[model samples]
Target: MHLRALPLDRAPVRLRQWVFLVDADERAAEAAFVALFAPGQDPGLGRALVADDGGGWLWERHQEFSTWTWFAFGPLGSELGFEAQPAETFFWLYGAPGEVFRGVEISVSAPEAQPPSEVALSRHIDLHRCVSCEVFDGAARIWTDFRLREGGTGRIHVANHSLAHDEVSRLVQTLLEIGNYRKLALIGFPPARELLAWLDGAEGRLASITSGLATGEDSQAVLDQLLALSAEVELRAAKNQFRRGATESYHRLTLDRLEALRERRVPGHSTMSEFIARRLLPAMRTREAADRRLDDLSVRIARSGDLLRTKLGLAQDRQNQETLRGMDASLQLQTKLQGLVEGLSIFAVGYYVLGLLGYLLKPWLHGWPGGAEIVLSGLVPLVLVVAAASLHRRKKRLIAGRD
Candidate 1:
């Protein structure tokens, strides 16, 4: 992952946007060269040869991940040269694309007998002092980096093989002293701890999310962790900033108090106003990026929590409404059943009364029927009414259950 983007005021010049890691045969005299010139496709700005000191160049280029596949071209007709050997030296590329022309990289692995001094020496050698040089006949490799920036800020780096053992601390401190984005320099050995610390401490704080070999985990995981760490770091940093500011203010106040006491020596010192802005506040309040970041993250988290709470409340409200509707439906079915029960009771009473009347009539007309005939007719109506009521009750229950 990449570091946080530099702030507008602190943006570094886009110079050495590309970085190269290389290994070559010790016998090779010609240093390997990696560069970008634009408009590269055209005869553009010719070529600006950037010296390789300890700090490399920074440039502006577009890229996806930090890794890339690159095709090295051979020069003209020379099959073994850089231009002709397109397939000979295939390697992974990193950083921005070809748009950045901030600087260039040249690597040469040479024997002790033929040191870097011998390689870079030319008729113009006296005119252009090489910022860095190295010679390794046996196992040692010389790596250098350069920095170039506005003002006269820049640096040169030269060292032997085995990057792990090199004096990186001195190199970094020196670069920081120069305080220029253009300070070209070199660093070698697989990416290491010193480099990580230097990068994190320099410029703006590494973005809230960043990854490198030093972080020890895969890039994605490292990025996630770094983001979390960034939040805490920013908050802490902001608090620290305020603390420092207050301390400075206190110091200034003490100074003012001392100055006021000294005024007793003057004849008419009492005529002057006791307050002094400069004494009370020695410096302007500088905004820390870390503080801004913390605020942004807090706002985002708060908004997210609010949105989730609203959604949950709405869901619960909807569920309660559904329950209320169900309860209403059940009450309506119960009311209908109650009315049917009352109607059935009335029907039963009326049938009984009709049966009694029929029984009495049977006595009035004795030749018409036996007592059994009167009983059968009255019982039929009672049985039919009861059956109808049962059917209605069953239908109501089924409908209620469906609901």
Candidate 2:
């Protein structure tokens, strides 16, 4: 029996895949997976796992989500009535503790259906309202409506002509991965859209605040607003930091997976790679635009802050200069008053010395007559000069002591 990853399909074989969209909690998903698949078994599937339980199992865990794939070996009847049949693991999958993002059903017609009649294949998928394309170098053809069918799951049909066992698995993997990554990449679109509106208002406010810079308007208020704007921008950046990064990573994965398909052109259809690149680029561009806008607004805010601070500093400097001028005038007035006080003190000190000298020399003057009077007159003038010199010497001594 052809079982698990090494199924040998010499005859026409049918391969069906049901890829369910999973929540972002990898841990919780892994736990539920362990309880279901490995219960009392390996429990540690690591990242990628391949096993057999009446079918092939492909389980992969990523940072933000996980995927579980089960393929049954058998024939799908009459389009499987277009009814997607869940495998034995269906209940476990649905019961898995994660929110469904999207689920897809892939049905591959076996090698006998190789190079399926284009017209027939197209009509086969037409009932499903799908988009059709041929790939695998004319060895295989694919059809998908990309619409949620019976179980909110999109459908894809692959008719294999000459693909090897490994090639089949790899092809399925690449296609499924392309779908997964593409979905994850666009996850940032909604947040980016919402952020753009907020950014527009922030930029407008910043522009208004910046215009104030030209005309020194309400500097304090302007500074306050600038601070607020800075906080707002920073908050937005912090909030979307992971989302933006995830978008870029997922976008890259989407492209990589699409390229891995090695898609070949079918006469009248487009390759998945081309289709994805066309639509994915614009979403990525939107993310890019949002990022660029954030950075631009941040730069503008910083410049505004710098300009505001410079203006404030200049204003403070001007105020300080005015204050210094008033202080200088006050200092000059004090100097003049001090000079007058010093002059009066010198005169008063000289007068007191003369009075004491006259008293002491009165007896001698009476004896010397005119000679005594002349000597006393000259001595009085010399006494005043001595008083001034002594005061100057004392002032120098006091200053020297302080130093």
Candidate 3:
């Protein structure tokens, strides 16, 4: 509440004034204020400053822009008489952060049925076609071409209904805001046009990728293409989000200001609402459409990527099943070979045992006379059976451990 009530003064124009807000930062604006006012002159200052020259300057510092109102009340405006405005005094205005984004030249007067003389208006404004309206319950009537003159200035004529200083100042601020917000809103237009063209190309690429997907031609290649396209679309969307949002905010505010103007139709010109809507609304719509299209492209690309990945996954699953089946058949062959090897091992072991037993019997039989041979064939069956049983039990234990 306190900050809102902070001093916001327009130029001290008794019956006429023009105001300006340029794209300037705080440092440049403060420098401009100092340059306009002699050092230590007046010795009183705050966020607002009054130049020491015949016409004073109102310094307003805002976050993104600044307003420097150069007025001699009714003469010697710095911007209008560009050459006449002293270099040393107004040089700081050159250091502004950027070029002028908004400008307004207004004439305010006491209650009068007749409008102000066109003599001064003609110097800057094209008086032939003007938009005029009564506002604040007919407290004032303002006229304008809503155009930048050859000198790059906007003009307004206000026939005052005996407004006080604060009232006139508020009116000045509102008018200035209208022009500023409208410009900001429309800034998105050219970019949107360019973006639309870019989007067309992207859509074309997406179509190609989608077509490939439909044909089932090289799923890997199509999936790669989809991934690339999705990345590009997402990047574009990320970059545009801020621009889209700013334009939307500016559009909403510009319309809100128009509402506050409470404009009525003039005799020969369109109201502010009508004029801005014709140009700005469509631009905004184009921008909106572009934004929505970007989002849609992103979503479609994501879906396409998912579909391709699912197809690839299913293919991999089928291949894995075939691999598992091959392994199972190989395992059965190995099991039969292992049983045959175990049988051979048992036969060889039993033969070797029977041979050793035959030698022992020969020793026993020959002990009586040292001449008879002994046969061990009768023990072969038992040896073979015992060896087979032992080898089979060992194989069972090994197989059990493995399982």
Question: Which pairs clash in model 3?
Answer: 55-72
TM-score of each: 0.27, 0.81, 0.79
Q: How many clashing residue pairs appear in each of the predictions shown?
A: 44, 1, 1
Error of 3 at 199 (Å): 1.0
Model 1 agreement with the true structure over 1-403: per-residue lDDT tens digits: 2222211111111121222221233112111122332222221121222223322222221211111112121111111111222322222133222222222322212112233343443211221332222212212322222334222222222222322222222222222222221111111111222323433453233332222323433544544554555465455545455444443444444444333222222132221112222222222222223334445554544443354455557768999999999999999999999878867766776667667767766777677657657676767767667656776788789999999
Best by TM-score: 2
Pairs that collide, model 2: 130-145
Candidate 2, after superposition: displacement of residue 241 in Å?
1.0
Global Cα lDDT for candidate 1 = 0.34
lDDT per residue as tens, model 3, 119-174: 75566556676667787666777777877754356667676665665666677667
Write candidate 2's Cα lDDT for 141-219 as tens digits.
6777566656566767777777765677666666777888898899899888898899999999998998887876899
Query: Every model's Cα RMSD, please?
Result: 21.5, 4.5, 5.0
Q: If both were scored by TM-score, which would come out higher, candidate 2 or candidate 3?
A: 2
lDDT of each: 0.34, 0.71, 0.67
Give the C-alpha miss distance for residue 346 in model 2, angstroms: 2.9
The numbered model that scores best in lDDT is 2
